[model samples]
Target: MNPLHRNKFVAAIVAVISLTACSTPDAAGEPASTTRRVTNAEHELVFHVLEGKSPALVLDAGGGLSSSYWKDLAPRLAKATGSKVITYDRAGEGESDEVSGPWRVENAVSDLEAGLRELGVTDDVVLVSHSIAGEVATTFVNEHPGRVSGAVLVDANVPDFFTDEMLTAFAPVVEKQKADLLAQPSTKKNRQLLAVMADYAPVHRVFHRRAWPKDVPVTAIVASQTPFTDSPEAAGLWRAAQERFAQARPNRKHVLAENTSHEGIVTERPDVVTGAVEDILKIVR
Candidate 1:
């Protein structure tokens, strides 16, 4: 890989991996309606639906992750809210087929759209996005408009979080690790990481410019110990972006997950995630 591309990949992956690694939850008893593969172009994306009712909850995981992240919470959310809960493994992750080339938010949104339509979930969606998947949720909601009833962003990245300054700050650290990142075994997750990094800056720039639909109610749950532990300045920027995004339009709110880390929020502070989603469910209902 080119040095510049490598650097970009490293910069974004560091922040992403720091907050994305976790043990897959046990989904054994989930009230699954179906766990099937949906075709998107040439690749097959796996989707697991915990059946219930309309205004479904769609959970999108962060980079280098799979739907297994929601194993524990999906069923709980379904039982508590009595609304369908959906989780999927994006292409190149989990059981989904990998497609060559850089990761693109547009393609992700397309895959999601196709899968939902196949499942007969055309509208009344309540999106729950985490980390990099925030970009996916933002684009999906915007493109589909009335299809989405609301959204809950769980310590997810807001476009504002990807400022030039932060990218600059990432350079020194990323450059030092070039030899190591290149040397790591090329597993599926590693390949996906590289693809995301290859297109991180440019893709996020577009996301930064996107406006979340004004009518779509949202709640942003931000962790106290964010991904940027090494740099207080960067961490401050991350939190501030969440604040701004929460206040960017009406029907949006921000909740602070005190003492929680980004990676653990979904598991450790699932109540916060569930509570936020339920809040939106109330509004849309």
Candidate 2:
């Protein structure tokens, strides 16, 4: 072959090799660099930050659950609001550390504050909480009113929703579970840590009496199927709590979805929850 042709062939081969070296692995391998780990107060948290042009939204999961609960709903809200969205598991749940325990409402709030700081979420953010997380969101708004711009509570557990008799009936069951969890050797670490931060009774009582912050735009979405209570009185109590929540806030609103369970409001019925969240965003915007 001519010397010029041979030289051109060698150069082409070298270019191909360079391109291959720069190529990144696909979905099967390590995740994209955009998804990274951040450390909160007492836990190493893994999170996904989806960037956008508008305000930010932070998602908080329910009791004993992780941020995966907001898997379906958060992205939808991000799209509707045209803003970035942050979702992460609390300590002891999902991929986060199990080092911290007791998981009290206040601890949950602290974890959230630490997470937002780590993620550099300094701008005004909308907090979207699900199930038992409603208590955390409300408490945080009440305590740190300046941080949050709006809140969306989906099938939140409120105190007034439980009658005195209902609380009495569940007290023994909760204690039994707490005991059994502590007795198990495998779960001892989580239980001990959880016992320190967890206070279900106080959480219940607080929710019953906790008032919605007048400054924040709050929206509550009630699920059609009531999972915790079987009695007619309990059902009525749940309805009353939702009514009170809607009435308490100046910009509060409530919506009920048909055939959706407590968990389904954020998971199965993303459209329903997203619709309500979009409404709240409209008011805030």
Candidate 3:
């Protein structure tokens, strides 16, 4: 794909793949919190913790983003909700150890489980996941339904959205990007990006077959413009997916972040995101 085509395709699926580094400020903007490097199986993951009380709130960034995306919002959330806020860099992102392989939700979950155990935050977790981290939150909740009390999915990519047709729509761009990345010299960022794109379709295919545990309460926040400003059909499918997720069970609510785009929800619409988390905290408490 040429530069122009790639840009358009990327904008269409911005929520699923983030090739460039997040536009959020660097670690210098991170809140005054306890930061530590947690190791698992010879790999090191950097986690930032803001002390508070349970249930602990774990913030997982979207694809291609580091914990820095939460810098401005973490401290505010910690203060407003009085719940422990935890954020970390996934393997190959930020200061975490880089491993050679495709990015899988299961591995992400393992890293999370390790971090939570190391920090002694084993229960009452309120997972706050954005964009593709939604998959991590979904798998984690299902795998450990007993631990998570509530969840907030912000402009996330829910399983219901990745239908056969949608996956087909995503293939051309994903394949072109993967091929392009494969031809380049392997840097940490390129490797991570390629690995993630390599399995993007397959992961979503699996995600589409899975469902969120009905017992857990959830809040699905949908962005106004979504991630498909260039494709109306895809945008419609995205909104419908969130609606299905919200209405599938009791204690699930769907909120529309009017005038917000997928990427802007975390930066420009922290109030909406924060409010949703506060509401979930109330129910879980």
Candidate 4:
């Protein structure tokens, strides 16, 4: 079969295997909070506020994942910092409405801005972003400088390494799986979600345009193992991305966790992740 047909075939198989077969409702209960929908000139955004005391922190989850993924991480950061926490599902990933086109970095930033406005979180807020969220958060800070007090990147997405060849290779894969991927059951939804992320070169490029603000203390934690090492090239790509962050923000300290994967920062090393948040709080305070 030709490459195009082969990709479609693989996508079909992935769709069947990756359907949301395991998603369970929010067991933690109705979020103990309410979500406000903010409709922008172009998109609609959904966000929930976990009220605390002051100096609110907004949490953005990784790619192909929902805000619920940060369920454990958010409260821990909130309690540790003694500040309000906001976590929201970006469009097409969680309870939030999906956008008509591919998720763009600018759109994600706009969604975050609209959500904050709708919730009335106008203070100097700290934006905490994980994985791909690092890209979105950085863009937000650059676009709206004064709006952000500081930022903490948990295994952030770095774009300097996402070359044109990588994006071209991943585009057909995403186009083929776009449909069934969305229909996936909540549990298995991450399969197609990952595929879509594979095409997110534009989002990654946004990260290269700006560095973490000097006024904003940036914290990054890298996982021990690289997850997408299907090939040596893939492994190098992942390492290059991490290296870009290290090179760009040489002064920024990074904590490497052992026996951990990409999601480990949020799942296995909540203590470490929370510790980093606390460190940011100290600097910002």
Candidate 5:
């Protein structure tokens, strides 16, 4: 090799080592990261990760939504709480690969769990489950209680909260609604409304047999306005259901968000959601 070429090669190797050395690791002792990816059976999920302090936060977007849904909010939560925050797209949503069939509830939960595992997050996290994403968030916590310290349910879909009669009536309507949503160009293709309709009964049956663990802190932020409300009675039922979620465990609180509806709460009501997250932060620490 020529002498000049050898010097250039040595310089490039030195620069690479220097860059690697300069990178820092966050509290959980994992290397500092702002973005990552995790693959499951369905797709490889792209995740936005900001390593803050400790006890990270995971942003779970509602069904028919993706990590982009939390784009504006995840950063705020990380800043406010000074804790790591994670947001990602499920299969058939955002940048993740699409699935062949409908979104399976259990599989969705597994995808979330798999991502966190791949990230090597040793510390516990608070789940911010919005809209339809609530199912996977709650199910993840319920299945892996110790891994999750708390959860902030933002108008989440807690299957056990819906009555059998309610599910029976809303089933077909929701199915058609999702099929229409999937056909639209602007939607997230989460197919969440359909996933809920499919798993509501069995998920409820499993959770009903076992009581919610009282040790985990849960703050249920119930929305005042919801699309589901066609009448005063419908709105009232929605509030009642959220309240029930708050009381599911002893270490839980219910707060009614006055200004925003279900979807808007995630973006429009930052104070409401982050405040709840801060409360959970305090409770956990």
Candidate 6:
């Protein structure tokens, strides 16, 4: 794949893989966040942490993307919400330790927990997750409910993504993404992250469902387009699930990122997402 095509193709599959698996404006003319690296034992995770007064806002990337995925939005979100916006690359994805392990949602969750601790961020945080990271954020909320004050699921993967029907539906998308990705040699290491995600996805579905946190406020934001819910039946099922998730606990809300694509919800619709984040914080606070 040409560099241009590789970039384009990378964008395309980022949307497809999350179901197979599921930003901001800034001011001051510079990024508000400061970059630093933290160690979770052998792995060195690079983070961009914005210092502010409000509860922390942690950004989780979709599979195959680095923390750079939030480059356009985090600083703006930090300014908008008057909160710290923390973004980092996962193991083997960017500067983070290429720690070898299955991409179990639990491991992702653990990494965040450890990383947060290393940052001395004991205060509860609002997890902002895009794409399949819905699984990771959702699992973290489950394992450490007290640590998460809220969550924003931006076109995020549902907890039950691996239902028999969904997996059957999701396989083709995943396979095609895998094939396209294989042609991009520069991305081979990134695919290692994908490999673990694939191995643990079904297990994550089961784990998240049985223990999804119900105490904190959650906002489910859906992009208008998603590989997981493209057709009539799939769309209906997706909407119903998103709604039910919102209704699952008190103070949950669902919004559509009108005219937004899966990636755009994070990269382009920072204003919309930040609005949702502001609203969620207002209610929870």
**TM-score for each model:** 0.88, 0.78, 0.89, 0.75, 0.78, 0.80
**Candidate 6 whole-model C-alpha lDDT, 0 to 1:** 0.70
Candidate with best lDDT: 3
Provide the overall lDDT of each model, using Cα atoms, as 2-decimal numbers.
0.80, 0.64, 0.82, 0.65, 0.67, 0.70
Q: List the residue pairs that clash in candidate 6.
A: 18-21, 18-22, 22-131, 22-156, 22-157, 23-270, 24-73, 25-76
* Worst-scoring 10-residue span by lDDT in model 4: 15-24
Give residue 53's lDDT in candidate 1 (0 to 100). 89
Clashing pairs in 2: 101-193, 101-194, 102-193, 102-194, 102-197, 102-198, 104-197, 159-207, 159-208, 160-208
Specify the poorest-scoring 10-residue window by lDDT in model 5.
12-21
RMSD of 5: 16.2
Worst 10 residues of 2 by lDDT: 12-21
Tens digit per residue, CA lDDT, model 3, 140-160: 988886999999998887889
> Per-candidate RMSD vs. true structure?
5.7, 18.6, 5.3, 6.9, 16.2, 7.0
Clashes per prediction?
A: 0, 10, 0, 5, 0, 8
Better of 1 and 4 by TM-score: 1
**Candidate 1 residue-wise lDDT at 79:** 84
lDDT, model 1, position 203? 64
* lDDT score for candidate 1 against the true structure: 0.80
- Residue 154, candidate 1: Cα error in Å is 0.4
Residue pair clashes in candidate 5: none
Error of model 4, residue 176, in angstroms = 7.2
* Poorest lDDT segment (10 consecutive residues) of candidate 6: 16-25
Among these predictions, the greatest TM-score belongs to 3
- Model 4 spans with C-alpha error above 4 angstroms: 1-32, 42-44, 164-207
- Model 1: per-residue lDDT, tens digit, 208-281? 78888889999999998877665555567778999999998878999998779877789988888889988999
Q: Which pairs clash (backbone N, Cα, C closer than 3 Å) in model 3? A: none
